[model samples]
Target chain A: MARVRERAKMRSTVRAGSGAAARGPRTLYDKIWDAHVVRDYDDGSSLIFVDRHLVHEVSSAQAFEGLRRAGRTVRRPDLTLAMPDHNLPTTARTGADGRRLPVADPQSAAQLDALARNVAATAIPYFDATAPEQGIVHVVGPEQGFTLPGSVLACGDSHTAAHGALGALGIGIGTSEVEHVLATQTLRLNRSRAMAVRVDGTPGFGVAPKDVILAIIARIGASGGIGHVIEYRGSTFDAMSVEGRLTVANMSIEAGARAGLFAPDERVFAYLKGRPMAPSGAEWDAALAQWRTLRSDPGARFDKSVAIDATAIAPSVTWGTSPQHVVPITGRVPSPDSFADPVQREAAARSLEYMALLPGQRMEDVAIENIFIGSCTNSRIEDLRAAAAVVRGRRVAAGVRQALVVPGSGLVRRQGEAEGLDRIFREAGFEWREPGCSACLGMNPDTVPAGERCASTANRNFMGRQGPGARTHLLSPAMAAAAAIRGRLTDVRTLMAEAGMGETQMGEAQMGETGA
Target chain B: MTLIRVEGRAYPLGRANVDTDMIIASEWLKTISREGLGKGAFAALRHDPANVFDDPAFAGAAILIAGENFGCGSSREHAAWAMADMGVRVVIAVSLSDIFASNAFKNGVLAVCLPADAVAHLLDAVRGGAGIAVDLEAQAVRCGGRTFAFAIDAFRRRCLMEGLDEIALTLADAEGIAAHEGRVAVDAPWLAMAGRRA
Candidate 1:
């Protein structure tokens, strides 16, 4: 450890040389980076220690293969959690007799079997396909409380930023970096700039947290937050539930941010209390004491800042291939001529052709053939409750082809069943299926058909994301449910009014109103 | 994975906001191996017979000029693997996604960010059948009697120049990693879990 001692000495010397300048206010990203740096090189690069690693099937198989080829063992198996979700089917994994079913796709089966073998060889903790805790890596990390505040987490998937909601720094790495972290629990990287995006004021009726994020992305355009880590602030985020914060943070990558963070507070601690992975009793108090100091210092300078008014946003959905192609539900489809940039105008025109829509068509009038209410983005217990509030006493429209409600995890499914949400969904003609990444991506058996339009709660609306030639419109869980009920894009606020339940009550976390 | 200068014919496919899914679709990602991804590079655009990737004129182009946000979605390194396997050594875009840029750097591929005007001019020059040259040591792109200077991280440039192995370099400092672990044990007691957290 002579090198470590020398580095420590060098660091202290630099700190003493800087004096009061080094004691100035620091942002949350700065504090976390400082705490995790193993060594700093003079060439603007640092060796960062990673605390947690979340592994999944699609992006991790090659990483495991790389480790095997290099004759290396996982450095810290205790800090890694592997789950098979991306390629696993959301169809019935268990029968009434509790016997497990075989995976129909040979490719998915082999990938999952390889994952089990790899996790076993590394002795890393794994939630296998049939495990009740097995779910999307992003969802399982937060719900299990394994993604603690003030920590660094890395995953092979881009949406790992979801853990940023809990005040952890979640980075989406590639397979090579995954193998790097496995061999050595450190990464050679450069620090990203810190940006503050504050949305103040209260949102209007039926504007869920999903809507807020969508509006933000639409305003910022694609690639707006590149090369920066965004810190979400202001009253709108402060008033949102932990689940809501998770939803918002999950889509930060869509806006081109490295990761999105919300400083930890009482809501975060309350959500983690008694969680399966959370420390309890005296340990809980100790953890809380440290986490309380995770906020950004007042007067800390940010490289960039954006201020948004929450009241100006409304329930929104994407109409084109990119998340930035969004508009309020009351708005009509935009014409290519409306775009000042020729490239964006061409992209808009091509998107309209692919989606088979005219420029003047209203959003609410666009017909949909399918509705998907699951993904790492909006498949939590809170998201399910929100959709159930809209689907409680309504039947799926006859014109709509299929409607599915896949929970994030087995625990979420069990909880939804306990709340009679399963019956509500089943009675309303929507299939209540098991959990996996499902139709959010086309990796599994559940895929949208070609030339079909679907209202999806997934994060991406990219071309051929669901399937070859599949069309996806991004929206909130409640909005997707409303679309399933009407066979078109109907505002959830309108349905809430028809049922005499105010939109404010539907926004509540407790899901109290089960309209019979 | 080292480079000093690359001079070759460049492909001019300036589509903006080209996401990773377009580079390599999810169907191609199921493979456990990283080899032969060249066939699937530009999977979506290749569906068209007139797409630049399949066009005979740019069949083996070593450089690709693209619009802003060239690689914007997914953290899949396969996007880099696909492009590298397709014989692309240099990618010049107005801007690139952070993840894609890092992945490209790791794969020995150079991601150059130039002003929009420079990129637009390069697109026209390359389409006019002029070759492009990138000099990393000089930090400049030369083509059509014009030079466009750029900046890159010094450490990254050195790594690319030396072809250093990142994982091996990190493992050389195992003592430092162990020291960090010792600190984490006391600071983050909740991190210990043998199996499932329960």
Candidate 2:
């Protein structure tokens, strides 16, 4: 009894340690980080206590298989959740691969089979591809309220930062880490130094959350934010809605941060209020009362700080192989020497070689063979509407091989179709497919033909990611749509003007479309 | 579960940016079993037929000498499972993409991280039959009789060297948990009963 009480006392006291009670106070990251610090090592790594672990078909399979091989069961299966999206085809099919073909592809079938076997073998609660609730693992976790504020969430997906919108410090894990978490519920990780990326001022019209994040990634090269957890702050972040915040956090990994987070605010509470996994009634009210206090305190310290002006950010596009290879749509390809470092300049030169473009060329003039405006990164309803607004009256360029729109979730798909977003996409010659990670990783049937260039809304443009020898340029949904119509990298701002359809402010217009 | 140091053979991939799709291609998704995954380990490599795995260059190697960002995509445990199945005991890379390294460790594959220069040296040593003995207990690698240190998160090393999965760790505390539950059941029978009702 004394031992338990002593441990409890240590837990409570530690919560107030590390400047949490100092005059300068603690950042939200610090508070959450402290709360989850199960054990601290001399070398500065932490045995982080994970509150929630989200898994998916591809990554969870082997961890469960590992458990079975060891004659063990899932230790805290109740705290674990699973969903399969990566290899699940968008269209429903007769065979098990979930493809719409007369015959199911054996490889895709095997993925589903292994997922089912693992779930059944370990009794892990799963949302299979055939389940109505199944969607991208990142989207499902937050929507189901499985992600809560002040908790440490880990997933095998890099975009696990999508859950960081709840104010949790989420981390992406590898298969062994997944296995580690399954066995120990603790990950041996080196804690990252915190960096506050403060985006001040209001965004201009026609600029969306994707633009804001793309702008941030452009400022911080693809690896600039490496080895840090970025805590996003300031008026621009305050102005974004829950979904908008998720959009920002989702791309944090693309910028090379372990995770990205926004301090919980009224918008977060409003979104979580009646969610299935959220607290209820009196519990909800109490949770809200506590959540209201979960922000970085005044004068909190950050290891590094960067201030970006929201007004300075514009709709952006990538001209090379990485998310860092970006410039404002109005800007031209940069001179390699302008990179300021020979290494980066050399990397830029190599990227240019693969892209088959010369430095100093206008970005807008680069012709594209395909335009894909979907992926977990930018496939929510607002993303769809943004693309729809651009393609409502425009037809895709004739030579474009594939112009596709894939919603992130079934809920998003239903909502988009209800609002006629699908009609606008189809009218503009875009393939409106069912919800799944299509063309996101080229696991499913949707792939860019070899050696072609595609303007995509998906994150990551590493070599051969979209398809074998296929080149990708990551952009926002609207920009992708604009490129689809013009057969080149056309700025959405130019298309919005040409179409005479005004753009919506980031959160003000979209948060109004919430399910509640 | 014993910390037995084994000087496993090493294979050199010498490739950079190996994506998950290449580790275990999308076509092998049909079976629920991981039994034969290693046979198809480098399916994408076999797609070309003349790739390194089949070439005479690094025959009988048990280690994989790879480039940076060795596993850089979706967190597919199959990739790690495939590598383990293919008799790859150690994967030495200058740097590993975070997710891939973690996955590799959990599946009983050693993902060793060395500086770029150190990795190049290790690669040259392995090719020359200077067997690298991976000591999980010491968290060090002995190549050509020279002990060079590599870092592993101590907790992960404990789990891997013991071959303990997550459940085993949790179950290790099962007695403490049951005692706590017993106390909770006595103090808050309603809560205990509530669990049963659910």
Candidate 3:
């Protein structure tokens, strides 16, 4: 009892003078990231103790293989969970030849097998492709309610920050770190200073969480928020649903911030209530009771503060290499001097060479060869609805090749298809495919042809990140769908206006209804 | 893992957004293990790969100079493992990406943070062929014979100097954990006995 009291007092003393101390509240991430600080180094970092470690096939295979060489077992198997996602084939109806897909390529097969062997050998809970609950790690973790508000979650995938939507201090780690977590369940981390980005105002029509994130990434250059943990607050966040919050947090890494978080709220509670792995009945009540306490004080301080009116955001799209190289669909390609920094200018120059775009070209004028509307970042049912609304009756542009829509999860796929979203896509010349990370990483057979330009909804467009020298223009699903029908980066608003869609309703339902 | 205070002043490399591929090209990805990564470190920077590192232009540059988000994308340990293997003691940057910074620390690569302005100043001096010294004990960096104080997270400093990783840190608490486990096993024998029910 005395020890508990002493620890509480110690925490209060330490919490003083930090940026998080500004509000009369504490953010769930602050509570979690700070609570797990095992020790502070003189270097201004902390050795954070990781509570739950999630591993995947692509990165964990090497680590477990290394452990075998060292004759070591997973040190804390109880705290670790394993799954395979990135390399899984997207076949709705599994057949014997299902394993022939590129995701099932020899390397990926070996990795999947090794992961199964290691997990079985170590007796850790695993969700393989065959597992009914299996999906993308980010999707599964939340669906299973394994990610809690006050825990630290680490995975080898960059989108691990997706878990931060639950108010967890989630960060993507490397293979060695996965090995380290498996062998110890603790991470030697350098603590990051917290930056509070308070977003106010109501979001505009057709603007989804993906657009908001893209807008933030554009404002704060890809690396502008580097080494900082962004705590998103304000009325805009307060109005968002749990799923919407997840989408915003998922792309935090795209802006170069180590992590992004929203304070836990009633929406968070309602989302986790009946989740498979969430605490049951009385346990649920207690969990909610505890989670209710997680929030930033009314006057928490911050290292930096950036505010933007959510109303200013539109259906944004990226015209260049990094996610930050973005602008609204109505905007034009930035001219040379628009990039004040020399490095950006050089990178932009090179990107222009590959993208084949003139400096002053309007974003809407640039044509696209392929259109991809899926990725863990923006492949949810809501995302599909947005795209469907635009493509419901509109035919794809004459020259468009392989226009595709891949849902992020099986549930999302089912929900979308049941609502006739698949019919909408197929009638409009879009290929309605199975749920998986299809063209997101080009790991599967779904890839952009070499030297061809594509408008993708997936995150990250580094040179050859999608394919060898494939020019990718990142955009919202609606934008991607609009481009598919127009064969160019056409503004979805103009397409909707022209299609005679949205005459009946003008708000949220219009987003759900057919645009054409 | 030896705590060798960076001796003498070395110039910052001053490259902006140096990616992992730039640090060690993908051609080097064929190798499975992280060892020998040092030999190929900075392979992309040199026009003639071998001559670049040995050239007097960057001779004895103990502290790497980099711009914001020094390491971005791809959570590859090879990136950090190679940088450590390349005899880089400290990576002085305006900022670092999360995964890269964590990898650097686990492998004993000290990532030092200075404001962007200070890094820009240091880069200017280094580009001029001025050397910089980073004293671990003094917690300061000296460039062109002028000393500038720097800060490090106290905990990471200890881990780097001691070469203690997560495994080692956990091992330090092994005895206590063992005792706790023993108690758990006695209190809830079924928990230990539980297995995959086929």
Candidate 4:
């Protein structure tokens, strides 16, 4: 019809110069955000289009039910992906045919069953527990290349900020917001301010990206990034691997930031070159050209700026419940009197009571009952290799209770096995488990028992997060491996030194390389 | 959503950094239904026999007064759902987490952020068994006949007053969204996939 032809012409005209015309110098977040804004309201809210929607089991059942109740279908089924991660048991046994056995917990089984039915009815692509690509929502997004640079992605899980490391504007949404996006492939949001967290100098020996982010959270406190989108910059982030960058961006939510991103470069392009969901042929060329331009201008302005010296950051570990209750590995537990803020002091006292620690107690002397080196935060291939390096010939201490090494994705698990990292961990008294959000939160069967203390690589350490009355101390993969070896919170640098592994030697270590 | 004008006895829950886990434990999230969450709203706190939620005087209170940074952990909307299920209409605190505040607004629960001193005064008065009142249109909270003005985003205020959810507001701009989607279909073909089977 004539009307259809007229609309086509109008769309072509709008497409000609919409995203190509450069208005002025702008931050990376601003450029991507402005390009995606469909409409701006008078109240400073905008309807922004979402390029990808990742859904998991724990928080998405209600959202899909909302859609069903409203008699609506997913507007963009092609863009939405689902997986059952939170409730998947890591220790699930397989039958003779290699199919996973039924989940033991009735509630967890029902959650997964609901997810399967929802995905089946909606026709959205899903990686079930038996699927090879099944993993944590955040991990699977990047592994499959569904998370692209210069894109806008969202999910119901809070750690969705992990995808922002690829230069995407990633955000966490509630069930209501998830329903909104499902019915219409857009979100009503108020733009967040831009913040720059610049990391200068090079990271020292045994210092990982996890340590840098934990140190940053400690410096800024939990609520410092309340309404901002942080951009991690400077040479330190530039030199980090894509996996390391993911680790840093994964914990941005702990700092209360909406998202965290890094400018796309060769590292990003290299990581996405032949990914399953990446572009190909001429589309790849065009995508690369556009992604190359997705960076902060030389003189872009930010609402707030924080500079951190990477060299000054040691192997950081959280001694209390909050992510901000962190200290260097060599430091002692903080006294309540050291806290000037009454709220912080009270929080410290409560955390101390829950953790059963005394003031001025040495951090290295704190014994741990469990060690969990897996989560969306640090369960990537690089993180596994780092832990493997520390536990190459070392044995888990006798006093320690249990140690779990869970991969982030099936692909990462396969890669680790190929590189013999799994064998190393198992030989060192760790249980190599299947990939899922195991032991991250207590949603699955893998949990720290009551009255136990764990050194975890997960982002959160809230009360009852892992299990009721279970205490958690957040640390990096290497630090967790060191703790498992010493039966206490020990510094990885000191362990490396004791093992005659120097800083220069670790610098030459590469992922998947044997005999480090 | 409904136009909320809460006037009832307020329960004093003066705890700083009260996270979502304390509000509603993860074990309670297994059910798809939002009902029955009131039974487990403050499961951990209720473990203590002396907790205020179980006290005879505050049995059916509709308002909760808490300390700073209430609802600081997790993006679980269950925290808000549980509060609403427990007949809590207003939560007065010094500060609220960004996600929790939005969740409370969408679920017909009003999260009021006042100055620390005002929250302290409200806490004291509520502990003394004073009835509290909150007016969305006036952006004010009154306790023991003393009114304290609070600040809220004008858009959120209008939404609360008009009982408008995001979907309703978004539907008002349906034509604009249609036009934008049409343009995006040509501008970025990759993002326009709706019916393409994966």
Model 1 lDDT per residue over B1-198, tens place: 798899988889997889999899888877788888888888888777888887777779999999888899899899999999999988999999988988998889999999999998998998888889999999999999999999999977887889988888889999878877766666666654423444
Model 2 misplaced regions, further than 4 Å:
A1-24, A37-49, A75-78, A93-103, A117-131, A179-190, A333-350, A503-516, B1-70, B82-94, B112-152, B157-167, B174-198
Q: lDDT for model 2, please.
A: 0.72
- Sorted by lDDT, highest first, which candidate order results? 1, 4, 2, 3
Model 2: per-residue Cα lDDT over B1-198, one tens digit each = 334366756665655455566687554544446567887677656756666688666666667877655675555666887888777767877666666776776677778777766666777787776667877778777776567788777766776777765545555655544443444333222222211111
Fraction of true contacts reproduced, model 1? 0.58
| Candidate 4 wrongly placed segments (more than 4 Å) | A1-24, A504-516, B190-198
**B-chain TM-score, candidate 3:** 0.76
lDDT of 3 by residue, A348-450 (tens): 7767876778888898888789988887777877678878888888899988977988877667777887899999999999888776667776555677877
Q: TM-scores, in order shown?
A: 0.96, 0.82, 0.84, 0.94
Q: What's model 3's lDDT at A65?
A: 70
Q: Candidate 2 chain A, which ten residues in sequence have the lowest lDDT sum?
A: A507-516
In order, what fnat does every candidate score?
Answer: 0.58, 0.25, 0.28, 0.36
Kindly give the stretch of ten consecutive residues in candidate 1 chain B with the minimal lDDT sum. Answer: B189-198
Which predicted model would earn the best TM-score? 1
DockQ of 1: 0.58
TM-score of chain B of 2: 0.77
State candidate 3's TM-score. 0.84
**In candidate 1, what are the lDDT values of residues A43-130, reduced to their tens digit?**
8788888989999988888989988888888999888999988888888888899998988878778888888899998989999888
Residue B185 in model 4: lDDT: 58
Residue A216 C-alpha lDDT in model 1: 84
Candidate 3 lDDT, tens digit per residue, B61-103? 6678777777776676777878878777788887777778777
